[model samples]
Target: MDDCIIIGAGPAGLTAAIYLTRFHLSIRLFDCGSSRAALIPCTHNHAGYPAGVAGTELLRLMLEQAEKYGATREQAEVTAIVPVAGGFDVQIGDRTAKARTVLLATGVVNNRPDMDPAEHDAALQRGLLRYCPICDGYEVTDKRVGVIGTGDHGMREAIFLRGFTPDITLIAPGAAHELDDACRAKLDEAGIVHVDGPCTPIRIAGDRIAVETPAGPLTFDSIYPALGSVIRSKLAVAAGANASQDGCLEVDEHQRTSIPGLFAAGDVVKGLDQISHAMGEAGVAATTIRNLLAEQRPIRR
Candidate 1:
């Protein structure tokens, strides 16, 4: 049994483990070693490193920092989480570890196009298609861009894209009338073009993305997929934690979920899903867990 068990080795989980280990808490981290952060080749927006750094390198440094604090890292997939008498049991492979607390930082997987590498390689390599506006929106200033996705998230991304580019199009795979009057009005006021119906196949050539739509084959400098993430919240949800419509866990300022002894951060929780935000949430969660554990200690007579 350990004081804490953190699932996922991404920024949020690693940061939480580092903080908890520094507090002299025994912590174990379970990870599948798949972080969306690896998709980024170079990141210039993250604070610190004036010259910027490679995403893989930054992740490596974070892992090193966590290990230096005595946090045990194991490569394993967490199949399930079961509540026990005093805490929780984490099922990994055939083994189960009981912990007083658990932090779920397992991030979401971005839904990407299933295009062949040779076809979409250039576009993917050049950042023509992006998933995170908070990370790459600034780079699209004054450029014609198209966002693919439907529903509230798509509408929200379209609004956010307006900050960087006026020539923006929100391509929904469904009927335009599916949006409420307020959202439609906002798009109209923003001068954003809305195209309904299925997205035409996207063809990447040189530096432009040629998307075939019912309107016509539209060419844009960039395409953003605002499709919601498939957040892994079943473990926490099964433990009686609340979640949003998109399946992201609901947490408080302390990053504690509705379930006692269970906490979550990063994309798994409702937020901007940025590295900085994730790290901040992890710090808060670590402090909260530490306090909870301290309070549980028996007082000597």
Candidate 2:
């Protein structure tokens, strides 16, 4: 059996592989090739890249680094993880591999707006569409911004974006705004414009994105979908690991889940969804795994 099996090849999983391999542990990394980080056109928030780096490029570099250190990565989806006597059985179709420990790094999937796939991707490439304000709010500094969401989630995002831009509009995705009185007050206090939706037929024109609202057609320099994400923690949860109501796996300070020998990091865990944060968690998880395995079986050079 391998020392560990890491699911997901995002920044978190790759970081873990690098650390575990350096520790002289036998590991196998599995990736289904759907990392949310791969969708990022370019991220300026991640440190060490003053000019910024494309998500795909960053992932490529990390994967290469891990491979250089003897990390074995399989480009296959892991169907299930079953706990066994001394380890776990990782299933990939008809095949199964046994590992002493498992690390989950499956990230979350963003709930995108209802728009044409082609147009949506185009807008995203041109910076007319965005998701995480914390990642790129500075890019919209002082520019007109539109947030497609409602209720508390929408209100909070609008307020957050207010730091980067004074001109903010909150558009409901449904037929009307679901903002509570308190949410409305917060938006109003933040000087954010609220528009009733059933916002539809989002169009990209010139350097702006236009949204059709009940009030009328609205346009902005960029649009952000404040809709929440679907955390990819099902595999761990199915294996009896504790997870939050939102499906984020619950981990201790050392990234150890309730299920012994099972750990989680990145957006799959309940914490900050930043790349750096994920890598930090992976580092902690890797070290913890190394020590735990050493206690089980003596480690020697």
Clashes of each: 0, 0
TM-score of each: 0.90, 0.99
Predicted candidate 2 versus true structure: per-residue lDDT over 1-301, tens digit per residue: 9999999999999999999999999999999999988888999999999999999999999999999999978999999999999999999999999999999999999999999999999999889999889999999999999999999989999999999999999999998799899999999898999999899999898879999887889999999999999999889989999988989999999999999999999999998899999999999999999999999999998
Highest TM-score against the true fold, candidate: 2
Candidate 1 matches the true fold with a TM-score of 0.90
**lDDT (C-alpha) at residue 160 in model 2:** 93
Candidate 1 residues lying further than 4 Å off, grouped into runs, are 113-122, 174-177, 298-301
lDDT of 2 at 135: 96
Model 2 misplaced stretches (Cα beyond 4 Å): none
Global lDDT of each candidate: 0.85, 0.94
lDDT (tens digit, per residue) of candidate 1 on 119-173:
6646766778777778878888999999887667778899999999999998875
